[model samples]
Target chain A: MTEATHSAPAPSPSGFRLDRSSWAWVGVAPFLLFAVLFLIAPTFFLIIGAFQDADGHFTFRNISNLFQPSIIASYWISIQISAASAITGAIIGFFMAYAVVLGGLPRWLRPTLMTFSGVASNFAGLPLAFAFLATLGRTGLVTVFLVKWFDFNPYAHGFNLLSFWGLTITYLYFQIPLMVLILTPALDGLKKEWREASSILGASPWQYWRYVALPILWPSLLGTTLLLFANSFGAIATAYGLTGSSLNIVTILLYAQIRGDVLHDQNLGYALALGMILITGLSNGGYIWLRARSERWLR
Target chain B: MKTSKIGPWIAFTLGALYFIIPLIATFEFSLRLKRGEYSFEAYRIVLGDPRFQATFGYSTLLALATIVIGVLLVVPTAYWIQLRLPKLRPVVEFITLLPLVIPAIVLVFGYLKMYNSSSLLPLTSSPWSTNLLLTFGYVTLALPYMYRAVDTGLRAIDVRTLTEAAESLGAKWPTILFKVILPNVRSALLSGAFLTFAIVIGEFTMAALLDRPAFGPYLQLIGANRAYEPSALAIIAFFVTWACMGLIQVFGRGARGASPETR
Candidate 1:
């Protein structure tokens, strides 16, 4: 597809050559204008605002203010939850994808899993939070069933569906499905010949995974884990809907700051957004770079 | 082989249980709003509520507008890139992926700052303009998926040959684009539109922070106060998302079957 597009024949020498080139650009002008006004400009404004003080003088104070204990704690908690969910989601989703793709399962299950993953991955935000709450809240169906059938209550066992762990669990609902969706293709990239050759050469399954499969899959695995981390790190709605103001995740803190200027510094909110962009940006950059690396082998 | 299949069955079973149990639980809880028996009382109240009607209707309209605007903006650029300036593909794709790198909250924060009432553009100066800004924000959010879908669609068809064929027939640019190129990618456009609908319907951050009375904020509001209605809303939202994905699959399959090149 790319080759066909790139290989468009150059127009024969004619007076209309210049006109045609310019007109082609005109076709994309409206899209470029919309992107500038809405996407690029607003983000650049915040990036610039993050460096400016109230008086419009440039200062590093906003960035420095991020180190304050409460702010640091919020970022730390956000990172922890994101990391926890990403790692757990990666592991569980890998197993599930493996089960569907390579576990000798029925052929019908692949499309079913893919379609479910599509729905589940997009089935996020406030409604996702509500779903988890209805499933695990104090009077939830699962909670009541556990009490009645198993003689135990998660709440009595010190499990609350409104804490750091609670938030991680909720995040995994989407994270796992996203992992399954992305990693399935990478798993498909693993040629069966390599596994068959390894097995015929008397390598054990564990050895094949450790020596060959793991090395081949490492970049995608780690890169996707980073992607998942970024995915949850920047999310606010689910955490906000699940825990409200009780949990001090960075996103919730920024939400509060955005709503009421709780930090008493508008620039600091820009700084908060800057901090989020930097983290998600770096992880996504890593994901893209490692994806390029993996593509070399996969292709 | 039997042992290997057992492991897969267990994994598949656990995954299915994890995914499905929540829906079952939410549905059960939604039905329990009337106290004694399973009933659609929560769905009834939620469906009948004026606020629910208003917010859901508002979001549906916004989602439709976002789809139309997104399609209008994406299709031309993608087609132009594929047909004319293939060199700009990387730059355009990078820009589309920017939203994923930057969170929606951060993007909306940027919009709030850049287009505030005091700003020169003053997009938020009026309800109409603010809604416009909100719609644009959604277009930005959905840009990545929309562009990828349309670009893939454009690629599947023989864009160069189709363009030349239409040109030889004396079809102008607009006619060639609309009549010749678009119908070839109808399924792709529908798939992208439905995905955008799923995304914008219950979106929380942009709608909430923008102070729009869309369904996302409505869901958050109800979740904060009401109990069972939120569950009912979640069920409904899930169905909407399911419908969108199902339609995409349906249209996507149709396109594959219709286009010999796709196979």
Candidate 2:
């Protein structure tokens, strides 16, 4: 925003001087070429393809096919999962961050927790799925323990690893830590003095956080949760590996369409991909907007 | 009732315990040769696997490629824009950050569809082409981090005065660029390079889409097929990320215009 506000200076160059700092454009060349060829053009190609028929004339048939009953289940399942994951991740992240920073954790353990949280937040995806499986899957120790001692049955009880809820549980391994990492730094801006000021004024702990801290943190917490929401929205590897595309998540569905038989036509798949892009895109856009607005206050 | 000093201590312990539990489970998972016997067989299998040999090397090479490209392009552009063309900062910042706004999976999906053929300039075939695409993707991804690092460093020192002093003394753009400004912003470049390297190493979605066997995809592949190898790979990856992060910390600690690495 500020860049356009500045006045351009007269140009000069020593050693391999270019005619203009549009040469800065040259520095941008490789990224430009990559984005145009790889990212921009192909995506528009999908959009255009979605609007066009097999003969390549524009039509809404592809769009209409998007809402057919066979596919409608996918939308329902995906939205539910995204909502569940987002809420679960946000709550866990807020608590852990609160515990670490505000709940007054011991000094040595805070950094250790922070570092471990950093690693754990990055720890999910494909690797996490298998780790969780080893612990919880049939023939696994924990499963065997429950089966023998508690008379539990994953299949009978619908505690199956391949279930929708199963994937959400797997997602928390990272989502909680991710929420912790992003929200912790923002919480730092709350400062001890503000809490002390609230307490000195006779505010209860709940009141201090409710009035003083929450207001300051509302934008960041919302923004960070949105980011976590967006992250799980696009998550493909974990669910894809865990359930082998049986999970009916949007990403898994798209991967199936791209790789093989999940849909009738490829173009319909592109539209579905577009749906994922647009939804996740809007969430991310909102996150960045809130983050930018809170930057001066938070950073 | 008056054990108030234990309050923060208890919270930190619980948080730390929650964080380390999964990792400990992973360590146990990786160490189990069988139910009763503990062993390093998983690590042995991972190290001995030929795919691990090739893919791990490939991933390292890919990360280096990304860092080199990130440094080469971002350093000059960040400096030139920040110093000579401050007006272009916002535009440059916007262009650099397009990657951050667009999710990697979506953008890389776009790239794959766009550049799958030979007609495009600089287009190549699988793995190499994919790696090249990744290098560009990473640089773009890296731009926001790198530019901020260098920009902050440049702002910390007066780039205008340095450029003028060099220009008056007959130092050409290259000399001033090479000797004065770059050295001054070396910490930023180091920080940027370190951060870029970490992102590249851990990147899975792009590499998987482009069909390269980088570390992230390797983890996905191993995790799907084997029980324990994934744990080994994850630990290795965690260490690599930790080392890169540590390097960035070192780079961040040094004086601007000086090397951050210990002599």
Best by TM-score: 1
Clashes of each: 0, 3
Compute the lDDT of residue B58 as modeled in candidate 2: 86
Cα lDDT tens digits for candidate 1, B1-263: 32368888898899899899999999998999887898999999999999999999999999999999998889878988897789889989999999899999999999999999998999888989999999999999999999988988888999999988887776666776778888998998998999999999999999888888999999999999998999999999999999999999998999989875441
Residue pairs clashing, model 1 = none
The C-alpha stretches of model 2 lying farther than 4 A from their native spots are A1-35, A139-156, A191-193, B1-15, B118-130, B141-144, B255-263
Candidate 1 runs further than 4 Å off: A1-16, A20-23, B1-3, B260-263
Pairs in steric clash, model 2: A38-B110, A38-B111, B184-B257
DockQ of each: 0.60, 0.33
Docking class of 1: medium
Residue B240 of model 1, lDDT score: 98
lDDT of 2 by residue, B200-248 (tens): 7767777776777777777777876887777777667667767776776
Q: What share of the true interface contacts does candidate 2 keep?
A: 0.25
Report chain A TM-scores, every model. 0.93, 0.88
- The 10-residue segment of model 1 chain A with minimum total lDDT is A1-10
